[model samples]
Target: MNFSAPTGNGGTALLRRLVWLRFVAVGLLMPGLTIWTSPVRANPHGGSVVHGDIHIGAGTGGHLQIHQGSANAIINWDSFSIAAGELTQFLQPGTSSAVLNRVTGGDPSAIHGALQANGNVFVINPNGILVGPGGTIDVHGLVLSTLDVSDGEFLAGGDQVFKGASDQGVTNLGRINAIGGDVFLIGKTVTNSGAITATGRVGLAAGEEVLLTAAENASGERIFVRATGSGVSGTGITNDG
Candidate 1:
């Protein structure tokens, strides 16, 4: 059954099959190919917050719900915190070219965003994920992420968990609490210094070094902490919350 360029009763079917295969093959190898759950876009106006692989939005100290439509959320503030009763997710799956799946914030812990989610708050940045020194994540649901996972609750068994491993790294120096979920952080290298209060569990999976510290949670839970590897500075899971 030579179907490369068949010319028989099954030629049309063969051609269709070949075309489908070619489409898939090209989708995997093409340079400018895009695959996403929705059409993700960047902000028409630019955001200013930045640090390494992290970039934040203009939070503005208002209750704004970011739908992951055109750009990553860059939270900013003047004096108050931002409140959002929605889950911030990526517009689509990540590609190295346009990994539009990251959430960053202002420095000095000035920007505080309160998030409420039914499932998981996802940040699937292939470049890298970073929570700055002045950033804050306050959520009441699972934070499903591929790299940096903190500043919120991480509920387990949430829908469409993005466990994709990033080559860069995952670093956090803020605060996180999983009131009813698990905050799972997976990457090549992971660093945690702020605070993580997980009602379910807190996980850190890294390839090279994993830096962390223990702290007391809001509920008076004293958890031990430590770390391994060279680049990391904090002690192994020592509780300091």
Candidate 2:
């Protein structure tokens, strides 16, 4: 499906940021210029395994690791963020293992460091999700959304449906690579001005309700979004890179 260009004030702001980033690339740094940076470190805090058997550990120098024993795991976090030099690693059982990370502390997640996962990783934050300029994500599969999915539906292990009323959106200004997997970005507004490499499909859906079909082959699956329904107007999707 064709995604229209981003509209509304949010879209305008994103375009402006993209332009400013271009200026930054040319070594144009004005005095007192404000740069966007995450206020937190790379370590993810206040995380608990809510629906699976997992081990959480910390290492020196702002590193966090999660070892999952279950095929599907659900983790709830008060806040999930990463700074420029921090790292969060996930060790799953296999490439098909999936982890759902839901942030409930009414704050957006800013990922600016590195997030490495052996399997699929889903991050849901109603406030929003930002992958800043220095951020990097390497995973088997990745889903970054501002939508909400129920725990029952998540563990049921079929096509995952997400719905939410959040006005905030998801933005990516860094690098995301899904090795032999798909990358899905869903939100009320979705913008990508960085690099995204995936052997499978790259789906960007903007709406209140989104459907992520299960992968059928090694390539990946599809993403569907209801764009014209009531209360489903969004800024749409923008990819400047």
C-alpha displacement of 119 in model 1, angstroms? Answer: 3.7
Best by TM-score: 2
User: Listing every candidate in turn, what is its Cα RMSD in Å to the true structure after a full C-alpha superposition?
Assistant: 20.0, 7.1
Instruction: Return the lDDT, model 1, position 48.
Output: 32
Cα lDDT tens digits, model 1, 178-229, are 5564565544444555666665556544332222223424643322112222
- For model 1, the superposed segments whose C-alpha errors exceed 4 Å read 1-62, 66-118, 143-165, 208-241
- Clash tally for model 1: 35
**Candidate 2: segments with Cα more than 4 A from true spot:** 1-38, 215-221, 227-231
| Residue 210 lDDT, candidate 1, scale 0-100 | 24
Q: How does candidate 1 score on lDDT?
A: 0.33
